[model samples]
Target: MFGVTILGNNSAIPTLDRYPTAQIVTCNDQLLLIDCGEGTQLQIAKYRIKRGKLRYIFISHLHGDHYFGLIGLLNTLNLMGRVDPLSIYAPPELEQIIQIQMECSGTALRYEINFVPLMPGYTGVILEDKDLSVSCFPTQHRISCFGFSVELRKKKRKLIPDQAKAYEVPAAYYGKLQEGADYLRKDGLLVKNDWVTIPPEKGKRYVYCADTIYDVNLLPYLQDADVIYHETTYLHELEGRAAERFHSTSVQAASLAAAAHAKRLLIGHFSSMYTELDPFLEQTRPIFPNTDIAEEGVTFLV
Candidate 1:
């Protein structure tokens, strides 16, 4: 169930056919909402996502298109009588913006929100739980922006059944062995945990490069990702315009993914002026054949 569901792929404006930038990453039972643009709640409803499982929100920047619907979503969760605590990771100014909105409207949330502010020029691990690890890096945008790297780690150690049985270990205690606990024998002998158990399986990594200009420095974060989502706001022909607007072109995004050796690339945040999205794929796929369009409501497994 580790996958990313695109809610709104369009950038800036919400056209009749597309909304703005929003996505939901499903990490096992938990859900992470990234970049709550306008109409995100409706899109969530349309997709029938389990809002109750949503535990975290990650905003890339303060642009209206990136976070205009955040306050609304928080309020909706409050009105829905949510009691679970929610954690948010974003720029430092987001706290003030949320506080002002809550104050002006006289709204008190039913659930607790823990906001972790991301400071300028910071690039390091922000979260590490039992089953997940998350880090953030600065992206080249018009304002202070960030890209998130979310990883789902395997928890249980790999057990060697043959070795365990050769040591006369019972199957009843296999679960404890998988939890990395030493086994005590009836004759006062001991079996070390690592002697019969191997390391856990490889983790699944997903990186979201939220709105950035063509920059090679991001390769460190994007390297070897199971899925890398990069914004392709324009075609290669509009390279100059994309640079002026601090956005990326289709070719640039694909080139970065190829250079980083990411397993797959999801390109979105398309400009509203473009009626057709085929050109984006046509230009990007030639460079990176494993690229996807990041279509709305479509989930890509990582």
Candidate 2:
């Protein structure tokens, strides 16, 4: 279930059909919300994303389109009587902003909110739990913004059923064998785990380049990622406007993905001026054939 669900893909303003920038990264059973833009909660409901499964939220910057829905989402969770704790990783100033909102409304959340501040120019692994690990890197945005790379670790060894049976190992012990544990026979003979198992396969990776200008420095973080989400706020014709606004054009996003050798590229965060999104793909696919518009409610498997 390693995939990304696009909740809102539009930029700054919320249009009649398009919302803002928000997405859900589904890593197995865990769900991570990336950038709670305006109308995020409604999008979640429309998409039928299990809200209780959401464990973490990552905000790219302090931009209104990126995190304006945080307070609303939190309030909704509290109103629903949710008691599970939630974690948020964002710029340091967001903590104060959220605190002020909570104070003004006198709303005491039922669940614990753990706010992890992402300082300026910070880049490192921020979380590691079970089979999931997430790292953050600085991006070239108007404000201090960051991109996230989520990796799903593969820990279990591949078991050879034929070899295990050759050693007369019981079927009940196969689980232990996959954990790299030696199997002991009834006669006290040990069957080495390596004889029946191979090393685990490499894990899958997903990179989210949240709201940033076209920059080649991001290649290192996006290298060989199974799926990458890069903002394409405008078409190629508006390349100048994109650069002036610290946003990316369709061609720029595809170029970055091609340079990084990413398996798939998901482009979104389209400007409000564009009513139809077909031109984005028409322009980007020529540069990077794997590029796809990050359509709202569509989940792209990583």
Q: Write the per-residue lDDT of candidate 2 for residues 1-302, one digit (tens) a residue.
A: 89999999999998999999999999999999999998899888889999999999999999999999989999998998899999999999999999999999998888999999999999999999888999999999999999999999898999999999999999999999988999888999899999999988999999999999999999999999999999999999988999999999999999999999999999999999999999999999998999888999899999
TM-score result, candidate 2: 0.96
Worst 10 residues of 1 by lDDT: 121-130
Q: Estimate each model's TM-score.
A: 0.97, 0.96
**What's model 1's overall lDDT?**
0.94
lDDT of 2: 0.94
Report, for all candidates in order, the number of backbone clashes.
Answer: 0, 0
RMSD of every prediction: 1.1, 1.4
Instruction: Name the runs in model 2 displaced over 4 angstroms.
Output: none
lDDT (C-alpha) at residue 298 in model 2: 95
Give the per-residue Cα lDDT of candidate 2 at 131.
Answer: 86
